[model samples]
Target: MATLKEFEDALREHGMNMALALLERLRERDRATRTVKPARRLTGQKMTPELARAILDLHATTGMTQQEIAFKVGVNQGRVNEVIKRGKWLTDDPQAPEAVARDKAKARLRGEPKPKKAAVKEKKVAPRRTNQGQLALGDL
Candidate 1:
């Protein structure tokens, strides 16, 4: 019969061998299933200047949402948004009322001064008295 120490050593060796075999089998399976394919470039829909103008015009005149314009123009809403952001629709000489409002909002966010509003005059109220004819704690 093997000694207690010999038995423990044999068991440990067997467990290690089993673990290594399992890892090797997993590696082989992974290698068999894995395919090495060439990375493809991501191509998105390209918008021309005319298309951008049309999108802006539809949004401005028809009150159409970005999603609606994207659907009509065969592009994504994000692409439409990008075109609108970079286009001259907002920054050009023919600034739309919405563009002017957007510019004002941007300027306000940048700490630019806007037209001051008329301040309302506050009315002062008399202090409250308790039923005992003493001043209330809140008044104090």
Candidate 2:
């Protein structure tokens, strides 16, 4: 309950050491009475697509490694791969590459005119029994 003037007078009468001790106690009391919050975690939450694109672009163009960029962006280094490669691998959706590729093949087979379809159909049926001798992966 010491007033500022009283405290000042007391400090003058006492010593600097006593004043510093009192100041420390006052600071402690102030902290205890106040709703002091903890320091915030520096890890950011989310990165927008534009930010992700920028980060991946920076990784692709700069000397800095993906790990360093991921850390800066508050994401895993693998996310750098996903971001750069698109969601092709990391995606869990059922409509991914395998399904889409199947759909495309089906479409290509069904899209051509009836004559070509009939020809391809006959070839598929009359094939030499082995999938060999065709334009395979090497042709691709």
Candidate 3:
């Protein structure tokens, strides 16, 4: 199937100026009628108590799904689920699991070195014996 651009090129090849002008006018009309919505936030907003409460209220009051709530609140759907199900981000406590995770993420984004855990010695395993040396019935 030929696209509009291809059709336009064909029309131009045939010197169909009137059709090309019509196509351009149609494109202008489409551009004029098209409504442009503000782009949704690509990065999630910082979760706060108020935002958590708002998420909860939206969940309780409306039939919005976790994804819809996340879109509305500019947060991850997982974050919305945490807020609704586990009551996460309801406080400003730095010790909270979500807060701690967020802090760790920010630290990672800033190129901070991760804390190393104590190294454990690996257990050595013996290699398995192959059947390459075994004589088969055909060989015998």
Candidate 4:
């Protein structure tokens, strides 16, 4: 890839000073579009029973906002509201008792044990490298 210096040199040679203004305008448009978009979607992590109880207690006793509870519990505010409304940590609609029983029976017939919570893995970021193949100290 051409370096920034090389790009600037090429622009100068071509007498394209107005191109810089166009580039700046394009960058501003990109930034504006990005800021106008909604926040990222929530990760599809299920709330544990203990977490649900904690959310309910916090809401009842302290009258904390759903967003606050969500921050404390590491979930989205919608999840906090859902748990408060349903009285359970469920990702979907509550099944009828008979339907639940039938599902359990089918699971047993298929020799499937109840699912357990999977551990959340932390993401590791690679160190940024410069064009010259040296570590980028700006990140540090």
Candidate 5:
């Protein structure tokens, strides 16, 4: 089946200017009728006790899925799952696992270098040899 774009291309190929103009007018009318929605959060926000509570409340009170709850709360879906299922980030304690992880992430974001692990020495590999137009055509 030909798509609208394909049909438009065909019309253009056949020099149907009137039909193309009509499509443009229709597109303009459709755009005019479309309702504008407020921009959604693109970046995930730092998860707090309040945010976790909001996620839990949404999970318990509404039929919203983890992704929907995450979107509404402006956090990761996995964070939402943790709050709903495992009950992480429900406290303001800095020693909590989620809080520690969030602190580490913030540190990394602030350009602080993480503690380095013990370096493992890798075995050196010899480069492979290749004949570049040096072998005769009959050489196998």
Candidate 6:
């Protein structure tokens, strides 16, 4: 393993191309060991199939604007556009165990089924309720 100072010295002497490749490999290794977050809560709101249907139904029946949906739902108009235009993330990557665990927690809260592996995990990492009777994820 080359010290960063040594690598920088090499970069200064030999030029960036080779040293940069080695630096990138080091960064990749660092990233591999790091506990990366699975999902980013974007400016876009999360819309379940139910929420998607609700938005569509409202628009189809009432001819509401993006601003109207945003106001009614209490999200940004951009979020409404993302939901109505781009889409939501439902079928997420299965390899993400953390995401799977979160989904299991959410499903249990919603009185829904979990997969076999998720059901097994439910007994272990399931959240506790507060004195206020909150499930801890809070309202969307």
TM-score of each: 0.30, 0.30, 0.60, 0.36, 0.55, 0.31
**Relative to the unseen true structure, what is the C-alpha lDDT of residue 128 in candidate 6, on a scale of 0 to 100?**
64
Report the C-alpha lDDT of model 3 over 1-140, residue by residue, as the tens digit: 99878999999999999999999999999999999786788677988999999999999999999999999889989999988889998999999988899899999999999989899999998888785597789997
lDDT digits (tens) for residues 1-140 of candidate 6: 99878867888787778768878899899998999675433355554556656666676688789889776765667756756775543335554554566577889999987556534443466576556654556663
Could you give the candidate ranking by lDDT, starting with the highest? 3, 5, 4, 1, 6, 2
Whole-model lDDT values for every prediction = 0.72, 0.67, 0.92, 0.75, 0.88, 0.67
What are the runs in model 3 whose C-alpha is more than 4 Å off? 28-36, 40-43, 57-77, 121-140
Give the lowest summed-lDDT range of ten residues in model 4.
90-99
Question: What TM-score would you give candidate 2 relative to the actual structure?
Answer: 0.30
Instruction: Tell how far residue 13 is off in model 6, in angstroms.
Output: 70
User: Which candidate should be chosen as best, given lDDT against the real structure?
Assistant: 3
Model 3 whole-model lDDT (C-alpha atoms) = 0.92
Better of 1 and 3 by lDDT: 3
Worst 10 residues of 3 by lDDT: 126-135
Candidate 5: misplaced stretches above 4 Å?
1-6, 39-46, 50-77, 116-140
Model 1 Cα shift for residue 3 (angstroms): 53
Candidate 5 local distance difference test against the native: 0.88
Mark the regions of model 4 whose C-alpha exceeds 4 Å error after superposition. 1-45, 90-140
Write down the worst ten-residue block by lDDT for model 6.
38-47
Candidate 1 RMSD to the real structure: 13.5
Name the lDDT value of residue 30 in candidate 3: 96
In candidate 1, which residue pairs get closer than 3 Å at backbone N, Cα or C atoms, i.e. clash?
Answer: none
Residues 21-136, model 4: lDDT tens digits: 77768879988888555545456345666777888889999968999888877888887887888665532334845347657888999999987889999899887766666567
